[model samples]
Target: MKTVFSPLHAGHSGNVELIAGAIVPAFEKPSRAEFIRARVESEKLGPILPPEIHDLAAARKVHASDYIDFLPTVWPLWEASGRSGSAIPFTWPTRGLRGDVRPNGIDALLGFYSFDGGATFVKGTWDAIKSSYDVALTAAALVKAGEPSAFALCRPPGHHAGAAFMGGYCFINNAAVAAQWFRDHGAGRVSILDVDYHHGNGTQEIFYRRGDVQVLNLHGDPMTEYPFFLGHADERGEGDGEGFNDNYPMPFGTGWDAWNASLEDACTRLSAYAPDVVVVSLGVDTFEKDPISQFKLKTGDYPRIGRRIARLGLPTLFVMEGGYAVEEIGINAVGVLTGFEDR
Candidate 1:
């Protein structure tokens, strides 16, 4: 498998995320990608390559024009208001407020486009985010060209970004973008399996009404997780998308034994869908030692997780999402690929 990486991810670092109601430290950081890359090198999983640059048109396919406009330029606009640092959303457009009207000011636009307050942008955030999308697209192109699998080690992890909103430490939804890319090329059904500790709320919202892309997620139940809005098992896809989406929201303290059971069920569901490809929103935050995540998946369990996904026998694209225990991120993430290779 080829690993597509962008060192530009280092630029989007630094910002306090509004996690658990208080802005402490951000669980998503640059070191997370670095550690994973190191393990890939040490393990000699495969060759590492820089991502090919992709046009903004690819992103435009999945993002709202205004929302896409807001993320890359909002920081510069916000700083022009005499704010001397990274731009974080302090307000959001909610019910009883006019969300349809575009806000002329950066602060207002920030509130209008962002669903949550976590996506803070720094000076170099645009370049880094642009590269992150490119990395995912490069990985997608590889899969489209017949590679059995590829790893898109994206940063500013993207499962929480939707068509018009950026939240949950995401600006552009990489998995959604790649999945859409696959659909655009030739794939009939592009199935996204989000195994991140948090359900891919943004990914779900993006494809919730469509049938071409089937979305499934196994995450900490929203009743106790970070993005506390969606991820319930009942929120299946609507209209043409009905019965195409599945969610396995597990309880806290859930370990591999229980989590693997959910995974098996998900595999069974996918077998019926018979999609042309599989995209794994690979987040290892469920590791027992993960600082921000609960559930008791020991480090050793990650390999087994990988092997199980590979058992599906579909072309796979692994896109990085969340995992706070930076130390073990590399091994645990690589363990999935290792398991796939071994199997």
Candidate 2:
């Protein structure tokens, strides 16, 4: 497995969060990737390096030109609002409105690009997100090169960002970007397996009407999850994409026994489809003790999760996703990789 790294992630760190009704230290830290890399080294896991940018064509295959341009500039405009140093949005746009137009001002622009309150665009936010996208594209190239696995240690995880919007601390939808690249190059079919604690609403939205790319998510029930708008068991894909999408919304207090069953079912569907490539939106937020999540998965269960996925033996790319048990995130994430290696 090749690991994707980026120093630009360090510049994206800033605290502006709401927890327990108080703005406090940001749970989504840039150091998450840093620590993950440290763990990769200490474990003596495998080779690690930052991916060389594979040209913006692959990224443009998934994101819009306007949105891509807006990505790095949102913060500068937000900062130009004349508040303090950096700015965060308090309100967001909702459904029923046509989202065809891009708002130019910061306030309206925030609604245009982001969906929720968990994310903020500091001066460096776009730079960090662009760097993250580069890292993902670089890792995707490894998949094209026939590497069985490549870990893109991306921050401000991208599973929550769709083609036109961003949320849930994600800005570019890394897995979706990679899957799109896979299709653009030569893969006949691509599947995204998002196992974040919260639903990958953005990734799902991006490929909802597409047949060639299938999106499967095992997440907290939207009824009780962060991205409360989706993740229902009935949300099969629409149109030609019908039956291509799948969601397994496990309840809170769920453990490995139940989660693994859901994973098995997903794998079965993916294997039957015989996708040319598989991408894992690997998030460890379901850890039993995660401060913000409710799933009961222990750290040791991750390797088993890896082994189960490795059984598919398909070319896989693991993109970093949410996991706030910062202390154990690396072990758990890498555990999945090592398990795949053991197989």
Candidate 3:
């Protein structure tokens, strides 16, 4: 497997997120990708390549144009406003609020475009965001060009981001963009399997009304996890997408046994869907040592997850998502890829 990575991700550093009722350093950081890259090299997994330059054309298909426009403007607006710290949204237009209005002030625009406080921005954030998108698109291109599988080592992980809102350290939904890229490039059908600790709420909403792409997620239960509004078992697609979306929401402290059972069922359904290509939203935050997540998956179990996905026997793209256990991230994430190759 060829790995697509970008050093620009280092620019997205020094960010913060609101957790436990106070602001602190974000768990999603640049070292997360570096550690994974080091592991890939030590294991001789594959050659690591820099991302190819890509435009907003592919991302626009998965994200809202206004939201895409809002990204590059974040740093400039913050700098011009004389803000000294990383830009973070503290308010939101919630239920009964006027969601249709767009704010003109920097502070208001931040809140308007973000769903929570986690998607904060530093001066180099915009460049990093664009590079992350480029990384994902380039890896998708590799798979489209006949590579059996590729790993998109994206930073500032993108799963909680929705069509118009950013949150959970995500600015663009990289996996969703890659899935759509496959479809636009002549794939008859495509499926996304998000194995992150948190539900891929953005992915679910992006394809909720379309039947051509299938989205499945295995994560912590929304009732007790981050991004709690979506990921319910009953959130079956709304229109043409009905019955195409599935969620395996496990409770806290879920170990490999129960988790593997859910993975087995999800894979069974994915094989039945029979997509032309598969995109795995690979996240190792389910590792027992992940600080913010509660799953009990150990480093050794990652390969099993990879082997099971390999059973599908379709071209696959592994797009990085969440995984904050910096030191062990590479061992677990690459374990999945090595496992897939072993199969």
Each prediction's TM-score versus the true structure: 0.98, 0.95, 0.99
Ranking by TM-score: 3, 1, 2
TM-score of 1: 0.98
Provide the overall lDDT of each model, using Cα atoms, as 2-decimal numbers: 0.89, 0.84, 0.93
Output candidate 1 Cα RMSD.
1.1
Model with the higher TM-score, candidate 2 or 3: 3
TM-score of 3: 0.99
* Cα lDDT, model 2, residue 174: 85
Residue 118 accuracy (lDDT) in model 1:
82
**What tens-digit string does per-residue lDDT give for candidate 1 at 1-343?**
8999999999887766675678755678899999999999999999999999988887788899878877778777977898856687788767888877887888888878888778888887888889999999999999889999999999878999989998888889999999999988989999999999998999999999999999999999999886888989899999999999899999999998999999999999998999999999999999999987888998889989888888899999999998989899998999988998873
Q: Whose lDDT is greatest here?
A: 3
Error of 2 at 6 (Å): 0.8
| lDDT tens digits by residue: candidate 2, 258-304 | 99999999999999889999999999999998889999999899999
Runs off by more than 4 Å, candidate 2: 18-22, 95-101
